[model samples]
Target: MELTRLKKKLVTAVKGHKLLKDKRDELMRQFLDLVRENMALRQKVEAGILSANKNFVIAKAGMSEQILNTALMSPKQEVYLEAGKKNVMSVDIPVFETKTRTADANDVYSYGFAFTSGDLDGAVKSLADILPDMLRLAEVEKSCQLMASEIEKTRRRVNALEHVIIPETQQNIKYITMKLDENERSTQIRLMKVKDMMLEEAHHYKEKEVMVE
Candidate 1:
């Protein structure tokens, strides 16, 4: 007893469902990519941290043996940070690159000591100490990039479901319901007419028989 309008609405809803499914697939693909990137960045950060720890231990040992702090210490030098913006899936994150002089307080060496033997080792070790932090920054930046991309993607999907997909489905349902109602009404009217015609014919037959008799 479905009406034409209702049938058309069902067809529309099917089309909308297909479209939403495609959108969901695309969002999932993007999400997976971001997750992979995040994992890789995390591994890199962990490695950097391990390396930095090793460097710190070596530096501490060297400093203890040399007693070079008073004689080798130099004035603090400026460290400049230059950050660049990167966009991943419409998420902007700042990636910092450091520009600093190689010279450090520990870089100065006594005349008799080899250039790479004592304080220079300490300077290199200090750089290693900062390496972990630098890697951490990198990790944070990558994570932010990944998260932002995912958020935007999720937002779009949610919007599509709420505003477009769900509404379209409901619209189709409404149309189909109306069509079915109209069809039912028409069917009932036709059935009533048929019933009335059958009754009238029966009455005529009975009158004819009675007259003949």
Candidate 2:
């Protein structure tokens, strides 16, 4: 009975190991995709920031510091961000949403267009255009981080199941089977001895009765 139970447990462990392995593989694939996306987004974000900075520098150089500061003093835009989560392979990954409210194109330039250099407008527009991409980059990067962590955890579980639980369960089953076999052999030997003694006793009784007759 113990041996049968142990075999059942071994089967369960093996099945569980397979499932964990599959999950790990899927997680790894997702992780790699997220990594590639992160790399590309990082590059694009870096380039956008650099270009915007260069434009800002040119605008600053072309205009007085006071005028530039005045132009940027009053903001006509507001941004709202919401964060949530989505499930992937039993792992929860964060989702980010961005909502932007701008007064109007007319109000984007706080100061007169004549007072501000075209470079400033270019810089502002470029930054504005990249805002959504920047948010996307942030979301992707964070998801990559989370997915990497989950993958590592899943790998550890898979390794443990493969190396430890399944092997140990199999070993237990083997041990129980060996013990049961030995017990069966011992019982057979005892039964054979009893049968031989019974036959000898019957033969002795028959000889005594014949001699009496």
Candidate 3:
């Protein structure tokens, strides 16, 4: 290729490399934030589940099987959840919204207070409260997985541009420039040689004229 065209391509490659680096950095920042959120959500979910399980076991030991079954048969409250999406760095992360059917906290205990143990109430309440967080946990985890995949793909592209494409373009430009400069120098040398030969021939012709005189 010509030196001018090679230089133009090199400039374009450099610009592309810069843009990809910026995109990679922004993606890394977003990914890190999601990672932190995922970590916190995981810990909260685990602790909450453990506490709820402990309460459930205590309740089970205290209550008779028939009483426990009656208490669990009908739920006092219902929750409606809808999932949507939000964009983060061009990725669509899930958004979950929970709508509770019952507004009063007292309605959470559907079973009669006289038959069920306090431990059972505590367990039921813990599970209900954690449901939203559990949904949030699902959202964050899925987002993390998606972001990690995108990051990996972007990293590969950035590496290819930085390590391979840009370097190869620069080398090609250098090679073309050197060839053009060499051609220019060779043309200049040939012109000088031709001019010197013309002067030598003219001088001999002038001496012949002087001899004739």
Which predicted model would earn the best lDDT? Answer: 3
Cα lDDT, model 3, residue 16: 78
The clash numbers for all candidates, in the given order, read 3, 0, 0
lDDT of 1 at 76: 41
Task: Estimate the Cα RMSD of every predicted model relative to the unseen true structure.
Answer: 7.8, 1.7, 2.0
Candidate 2 residues 1-213, lDDT tens each?
788888888888888889989998998889888888889888888888899999999999999999999999987777789999999998888888876676453345556787899999988877877777798888888888888888888888889888998888888888888888999999999999999999999999999999999
What does candidate 3 score on TM? 0.89
How would you encode candidate 1's per-residue C-alpha lDDT over 48-90 as one tens digit per residue? 5566557556656665545445434543444567767766444
In model 1, which regions exceed 4 Å deviation? 1-123
TM-score of each: 0.47, 0.94, 0.89
Error of 1 at 171 (Å): 0.9
Q: What lDDT would candidate 1 get against the real structure?
A: 0.61
lDDT of each: 0.61, 0.86, 0.86
Q: What's the lDDT for residue 191 in model 2?
A: 93
lDDT of 3 by residue, 122-201 (tens): 99888887877799899989998888887888789888878998788789878877888999999999999999999999
Would you list the rank order by lDDT, best first? Answer: 3, 2, 1
Best by TM-score: 2
